[model samples]
Target: MIVDSLDIQKEIPLWALGDGEKVIQREFVFENFKQAFEFMTLSAEYAEEIDHHPDWSNSWNKVSVSLSTHSVGALTKLDIQLAKAMDAFASQVNSKN
Candidate 1:
């Protein structure tokens, strides 16, 4: 089911685009390319484990991430869960810097 934007906003303040269009977006910047790659690696594994994937891209030390439930055409619990997990992974990466 699609989540309410209000709830999403409270949970995901780092979202670059307001969580009103069935998508959650954020850009995570790391200290370096290696750190960025490490984040992606961890994210990829978690995504696979959960059977949900993100639309993302990486450039140098940055990773742009977008999450949406494509089959439902909206943000669902999975999207929120994945976003939180990704945020945690990003936080861990940054803390190591």
Candidate 2:
């Protein structure tokens, strides 16, 4: 099931509540293009492993991600889980730099 917008906003402040065509969205900025691309690559692997993917774009040092469950026609737990994973990955990458 898709989580309530209020709950998602409260859970992930870094992500906008109603972005991504009324789904959840966030932009991650890294130290450089290499770091940003690496984050995307890593996130992609994880997304593939979980069978959940994010609609995302990368430019220079920023990655814009929009997460929604197309199967459900709304944001579901899978979206939240992937968002959290992306957040964690970003944190880890930041620490490495």
Candidate 3:
């Protein structure tokens, strides 16, 4: 489906996938930098597998990721899928420690 940017923004934090109108944001917190980095690595792997990239930053134990479908001008299934993948990775990492 051609997920419109407007439709995606209407569902903030839940389905809003992408930076601005094209980026999805996900914040992950961990007990320490080691754990945060671990999650980042896993997330990187997932991004590579799908060939969908994210803009992210790491500050101590917190990591923020933003996903955008640059090719599409707005949000799409790829963006949503990537965001879900990131959430899953964060959940798995958090559960481990």
Taking all chains together, the TM-score of candidate 3 against the true structure is: 0.80
How high is the lDDT of residue 65 in model 3?
75
Error of 3 at 81 (Å): 0.9
lDDT of 1: 0.91
lDDT of each: 0.91, 0.88, 0.75
A best-first ranking of the candidates according to their TM-score comes to 1, 2, 3
What lDDT score goes with residue 11 in model 3? 42
Give lDDT tens digits, candidate 1, residues 29-78: 99999999999999999999999999999999999999999898888989
Name the regions of candidate 3 deviating beyond 4 angstroms: 4-20
TM-score: model 2 vs. ground truth: 0.92
Provide the clashing-pair count of each candidate structure. Answer: 0, 0, 6
Tens digit of lDDT per residue, candidate 2, span 1-97?
A: 8688887877787988665445888999999998998899889999999999999898899999998988778888888899999999999888887
CA displacement after TM-score superposition, residue 56 of candidate 3 (Å):
0.5
Comparing candidate 1 with candidate 3, which one achieves the higher TM-score? 1
Model 1 scores worst on lDDT over the 10 consecutive residues at 15-24
